[model samples]
Target: MSAIPVKSKIPADQQLKISPFKEVIKPTVPHKHANYYELILLEQGGGYHQIDDHQYDVSPPTAYFLKPGQTHCWNFSCIPIGFVILFREELLTRECLDIVYHLPTTISLSNSPSLFELAKQFCQDYRIPASQGVLNTYLQLILLKMNEEMATPAPGHQLFSPVYYQFKALVNEHFLKIKKIQVYAKMLHLPPAQLTSICKTASGKTPGMLLNERIVLEAKTLLSNTHLSIKEITDALDFSDASNFVKFFKLYTNLTPGQYRELAFSRQQ
Candidate 1:
């Protein structure tokens, strides 16, 4: 099993990259970026996109968001015309992070010409080597526009809370080592039960469930994409031993780690 390639599409010296989308002439293998977020805006396209566990159709006037460490691949039946925007965490402000945390992985941009124009402008200005400040402003506006299109009500208008988003960010950063709900609650300065309630209300999942899901997703990615042995993966994931890792994985996926790897490889063939 060859390791799944980790790609860095953005140049080393740049914190952001904006370019027009070009048709993929060959099948894209599953790969991930260790840092940065990718926003793809398509004016028109065909086929489907695989992001982690979700597969979304290549609909015209659609946007796809890929976060750091998430595996993704594209299989386009026809040429795709759009722009791909890549930005590192340095480029995100608190407000922008709020918007990004809430944006769905896939967004329908139909009836949203402003977004397309903004993306086009972003691509063009990127070539001019626009000032970082100007580029940051454009990125913020694009995110704000997408948030508006989501039609999410104001903070008070909805049952949502920024704490939930904060919790999610924390989990994304620490899920590999911290698995306790109480620890997360302590970090958030909320009681364990209150944190559970907030998570359930906001996303229909308990904090523990979310943590487990993240662990499971990472395990699957490693199993499917890398040649690491079971014991190696267990150690990397901080499991006590290979047997315990297999048991935990089976509980969530109903398949042992090796079996899951075989299934994943079969699908590729």
Candidate 2:
């Protein structure tokens, strides 16, 4: 049940997915893509949530900001109820988007109940069939409050800028098809060595390391959140085969995907 990440060929202003599903259907398995950002409100159920390398037990009043390329998934005792607002980068100018992006995408609303309440209210208001102007106003206010409350960005905040953003966007799109830094270098029209230099400067990691991080993040998300067979997850991720995915998982996590999933679920019990 992994939802493959889709690239937005369309512009952002016209691209938003808002819905309320109460059917208790399986949640989308953890996966990653670029181009879209999400504001999620979990008002029901409890589960293991993996966003990037960070995992937590998601409960009512929990809010998470999911940026493009971060993987996520859930494990629940019962079907969950939540509000998910998915929007894209180009929907707003970089100045405004930077405010929200600077907020750590993974956060616990329980730490700030009042702010959480305000977020819920904002979501309610945005859901109304209001004029574009009104909706944009509400969105800005919400982001402003979040920015005020969010902790200062880490020292490496520079990684969130244009070149780094472009690099990450590329990883989200091609991590499966291409595993080499040289491949990404070619796609970005830069020499492999130059790309390496840029990544090291921006993220304090080599291009290859970042690519592997993206792949491992996706692997963990799928293993913990979805019902997909190992073979399916492996194939979808463009592994040579399941064995390769398994080998890589073991190399990084020191556990098989099945073992990791079993332990993750068992912890919830």
lDDT of 1: 0.84
lDDT per residue (tens digit) for residues 55-99 in model 1 = 688888888988887898888888889999899767788777767
Model 1 worst lDDT window (10 residues): 151-160
Total backbone clashes of candidate 1, pairs 3 or more residues apart or in separate chains: 0
Write candidate 2's Cα lDDT for 81-173 as tens digits. 666666766566555666764667655555555655555565676667667666666566656665655567333444555666688888977
- Model 1 scores a TM of 0.79
The C-alpha TM-scores of every prediction are 0.79, 0.72
Off by over 4 Å in 2: 1-13, 17-35, 42-55, 59-61, 69-83, 109-128, 153-160, 226-234, 241-246
Q: Please list all clashing residue pairs in model 1, or write none if there are none.
A: none
Spell out the clash pairs found in candidate 2.
none
